[model samples]
Target: MFRVLHRAGQSHDLTYVVVVIGVVVVHVVLVLVLVIVVVVVAVIGGVEVVLVLVIVVVVVVVVVVVVVVAAEAASAPVPIVLTTVTFLFGERTWR
Candidate 1:
């Protein structure tokens, strides 16, 4: 009976160790997965920021071009009679 009890106690200790090892493994895997997910999210956010910056730069360039073109057109001279005739008809008819 004594020997049997000793054997049972030994087995119980081994079971506890196995359970602790399993828990530790699960915890480590979870931490690794979390790290990967965070890295992916950061990379995606960085790419999004870059894309937005590119779009903003393009819009600014287009706005500048439009402003410059409008200023040039405003500064150009037009004969009053020619302007009136063209407005009544069209540039295609004048050509």
Candidate 2:
């Protein structure tokens, strides 16, 4: 009976080197992907913050203007009273 004999003296250094290189490449790729994701998230967050600030500023300005206009209107005398007085007294006498 003839039996095939396998050699057990093979050095696994090449295999180890290949595996190490592959691991390094994969790690580099993952790190690059993570950096890109972080940068994108930061940029989006910055834009959102700026947009919110702008909206807040606009709202504040609109409210201030509305309040000022309302105060002015409330403090002033009635237009109808002035008009009636002017009509009764005549323009020259009132002036």
Candidate 3:
């Protein structure tokens, strides 16, 4: 009976050691993963900001060009006559 108790005690101590080691290893791995995620997000965040700015600039340029062209078309005499005719007849009359 004494020998059986001793063997049980030894096994319990071994299990405790294994649990402690596993906990430490898991904590270290979690910390490393967190650090990697933060680094990747920081680098990608800068690139995303630049890409968004470029898209905004391109959209602004396109809007400005469209507005300028529409203004010119409205101001021209031929388009004005064509618009009036289309309005009255439901279709454009081209001479």
Candidate 4:
């Protein structure tokens, strides 16, 4: 309805235009916010997966290093001895 304003009355079409623009802007902002939230969640989930994988790798590496070092220590021919040492905070020396 494209009705023109009379000389004594204001145009009703102005209010319709403002209402339509407001509705459109609100819908656009809501959709943009939804997209941003989804993207953020996906990024956080991806980071969590990477962190879990890194932890698993570190654990496996530590296990392998310990096994190798133990094997080497067992195979060594030299005898190891413990000596007593004193610390600054304690009067007792290590036995």
- Whole-model Cα lDDT of every candidate shown, in order: 0.50, 0.46, 0.50, 0.43
lDDT tens readout by residue for model 1, 1-95: 23323543677755434333443454467567555655675577776765665566557656864675466447634333333334445545566
lDDT by residue for model 4 (22-67), tens: 4345446756755565567557777676566556655765686467
> Against the hidden reference, what TM-scores do the models get?
0.35, 0.34, 0.36, 0.36
Q: Which scores higher on TM-score, 1 or 2?
A: 1
N/CA/C clash count, model 3: 0
Candidate 2, position 27, lDDT: 46
Cα distance off (Å), candidate 3, residue 42: 0.4
**Which parts of model 2 are misplaced by more than 4 Å?**
1-12, 46-95
Which residues of candidate 1, in runs, are more than 4 Å off? 1-12, 46-95
Give the poorly placed runs of model 4, Cα more than 4 Å off. 1-12, 46-95
lDDT (tens digit, per residue) of candidate 3 on 1-95: 23323543687755434333443454467567555655676577876765665566557656864675477457653343333334345442544
What TM-score would candidate 4 get against the native?
A: 0.36
Estimate the lDDT of model 2: 0.46
- RMSD for each of the candidates: 36.9, 39.9, 34.2, 33.6
Estimate, for each residue in 37-93, the C-alpha lDDT of model 2 and write its tens digit.
556755777767656655665576568646754664476442322333333454455
Query: How big is the RMSD of model 2?
Result: 39.9
